[model samples]
Target: MQQLALFIRKEFIHVLRDRRTLLILFGMPVMQILIFGFALSNEVKNARLVVVDHGRDLATAALIARLDASRYFEVEQVALSPPALEATFRRGEVKVAVVFPARFYEQWQHGRDVAVQVIADASDPNTATTLTQYVSAIVYDHATEQREAQALPYGLRVETRMLYNPQLEGAPNYVPGVMALVLMLVCVMMTAVSIVREKETGTLEVLLVSPFRPVLVIVAKAVPYLILSLVNVGTILVLSTTVLHVPVQGNVLLLLAESILFITTCLALGIFISVQTSSQQVAMLISLMGMLLPTILFSGFMFPIENMPVPLQVIAHAVPAKWYYIIVKAIMIKGLGIAAVWKETLVLAGMTAGWLFISVKRFNIRLA
Candidate 1:
């Protein structure tokens, strides 16, 4: 018993001495709890809403006020023409839009039939559905109040149009998210581990001393994983189309180009991790643990980024997967062109360049 206790105490002291191990033990759980608590919300909040009120009357204004007053919506009443409204959706500016036809209240007052269209960007089916239901509920409550005041049933029909995904299937959202998660973890894990193994075995120093440049060495190390990751991308796309039936709505070649760009970004991140760490175990741990939570939580994969606190949303913008996820959804689900996703593409490209710059810089310092 004494020997066992002494052995246990020695192990605990050794664990306490390693700051990285200690951080993984104590720091990780607290961070995960806080992030999941804040980020994992099903209820909609502060969803951007645009109201096109052709009516421009008292009833329409009252309904708009009610929408703005609700916690779920940030309502903006705009006189957008039909084409401009569609362009707004394609640009991913607003989540939901309410269109009240001309003389909405006038028709209601005359006991004539009328319809108010609720248009939502349904690329993220869950959020689109929730926002639509919230709108419906609000409209229903307004109708009920009018019925009571007039002592007659004033029926107001809420017609919901879920753009890009009329049926609201789960595949369209999850497939893009899964692509982000898989590529990030796999590419980062493999590239980091391979290079770290070289370092651990003292082979990396030989390569750095070789005729080829150190930056070339790092890129060479990442090339195999890049190829493998592209294979993974192809496999995922095939399954998504064949099994899940979620077709690529945009240019296939464009989607492939974006996927390659994102893969390169992940490889650059892996190189950075490899240059920072000295052990294969540590590199693997960092690649798996470091990328997993951020990719899942901050990438807007499992949760809505807007629902998180401001600090968390700021953290999300730093995540490369968040930009890539948005790009994938735009291309794969919404059929949007490069014109709509150039900003996100630029972000991923910048991140790749940044990570590679830092990695090459650090690798040179180690060589010196």
Candidate 2:
């Protein structure tokens, strides 16, 4: 116990003594959270809109007012003709173009289906879809109000209630993903680099020759990292809730427990990577390629896994972050209990067990 305590203390001192590494260990999460929360977002805002109004009637004016009032759009340009509208779109001056044909008000007065042409830049399919939906909702609401004022019979009403995220805010979706990414990168890379650095400097040989068993040495090295990772988890959660306004609707203790489990899994994988490499560069490369890429890409952190190709979807199942992300979204967004996310929890547990077993086996073989 005394030897273990001494080794853990030494590891902590080694980590704290390095100023750059210490900065990366603590600063990276804060920076990523701020960047993702403030800078990067899927929700459309201030998208430039061009209006081509030939009617110049009350109905056209009402439509223009609605578009301007929408937070998603900024009606900055009014094209006189289709050629000018095309020129605006070609020049990338506007994302959407609305054209109100002549007799738009007359058609509405006659209770006919009024045609309002909406053209959006489909270069980005997601953004285009959102813009179209926002415009369509506004038009539908205005049409309904007009009909009701004239005692016109109601048409089909489609009521959309967005569950979990009523405002469709991006922070709730991104915060949990950022948490998974930060924890995975920090735990895996730091552990792999620390172990490989020791091996490169010949100090690992001295530790191997000491009375401490090989497993005990590995565990002692990981102890400080595990504690530090928990601190990171707390920091991320506090920032996510307070600054980002992302709420954790589930049991906070459960979320922390799951985060610890994920940290352990990443640490074991890092040990495995360290055992496979002799140099710090190789360890860092493998950690980045093996953990970071898959965590960001295949884990459904930024993109929907269901939209991925079938082969890639199958590959994503092997990523630990994939399961962890799902578990987090379920818990934090949906307020689901353990019973709802039991399958993901079981998969993570299995992965941790498998990684630890393989890492222990490789460590023993290397010692031999």
Candidate 3:
């Protein structure tokens, strides 16, 4: 008990003394949350658009008014011809070009669907999609209102269903990704670098030469990190659920279990990396560039794998961060129980086992 307390105290002191690292560990996440919530989001507004209204009649005027009135489209240009509209898009002056066919109102009133062509830069797919939706929504709303006034049902019914988050609150998705990143950084990177630091400083040799068993030494080194990682998990959970108002509908126990499993896997990975590298700097480099980038890119945090190119999507499957992100999303956002996340749990277990086995093999090779 005394030894354990001493070890805990030493670890806490080490953590606290590194003020820069401590600040990054605690502060970066808040910064990332703010950035993701405000700067980067699927919900777009005030997009600059060009209107090429060939009809120039009451109906086209009304549609233009609707488009401008709604917050989505900002009428930036009123180009007269297709060539001018194309030039506006080429110069990136507008995201969308709204073209109303000649005699559009006359055709609609004479039993024809009003054909409004929305030309968008497909190179920027997200912007194109949003702009198209904005235009379609305005046109649909106007058409529906006109039909309803004459006691007729609108021809279109847009049934939009948001799968995971109905309200699309930013935190539900970001919080889980943040937690996974934190675990990867604090748990795995810290463990690997800390172990490598000991090796570089020759303390590892001292420990091995001591009477303490190798496994016990490893456990002692990892125990402090385990506690720190758990504290971080608690801190994030509290902030996300309480301040961000993201609900945890799943069993808290199940979430914690998955979190623990993820932490263990990361810690084991760190140990494996530490065994591979000879210096703290090398470990840190590997952790950041090699591990961190893949964790963020491949983890479905920024881009949906379903939409990614086939080869990139295939590569994402091997990244442990991907599985951890899925588990966190399932448990946190979807309120899935253990049964729902068992496959993810198994994958994490497998990764942990693989890393541990590698570490053991390396340790034995070094001993020999």
Per-prediction TM-score to the true structure, in the order listed: 0.60, 0.95, 0.85
Q: Name the better of 1 and 3 by lDDT.
A: 1
Cα lDDT tens digits, model 3, 84-184, are 67777788877888888899878877667667888888888977987797788778778878877767545556766788787555677777887888788
TM-score of 1: 0.60
Off by over 4 Å in 3: 54-58, 76-79, 153-158, 167-172, 238-246, 306-315, 364-368
In terms of lDDT, the best-performing candidate is: 2
- Mark the 10 consecutive residues where model 1 has the least summed lDDT: 28-37
Query: Candidate 3: TM-score?
Result: 0.85
Q: What CA RMSD would candidate 2 show?
A: 1.8
Relative to the true structure, how large is the alpha-carbon lDDT of every model? 0.81, 0.87, 0.78
* Global CA lDDT computed for model 3: 0.78
Consecutive 10-residue window with the lowest summed lDDT within model 3: 359-368
lDDT of 1 by residue, 1-368 (tens): 45344533543464457686445434443343333334544567899999999999988988899999998899998999999999999999999999999988889888676799999999999889999989998987887687678777545545567899775556677778878887888778767876777787787687666565676667666665566567667767776788667889999999999999999999999999998888988998999999999998999868899999999999999999999999999999999999999999999999999999998888853542
lDDT of 2 by residue, 125-154 (tens): 989999988889889888878888998766
Measured with C-alpha atoms, the lDDT of residue 13 in candidate 2 is 96
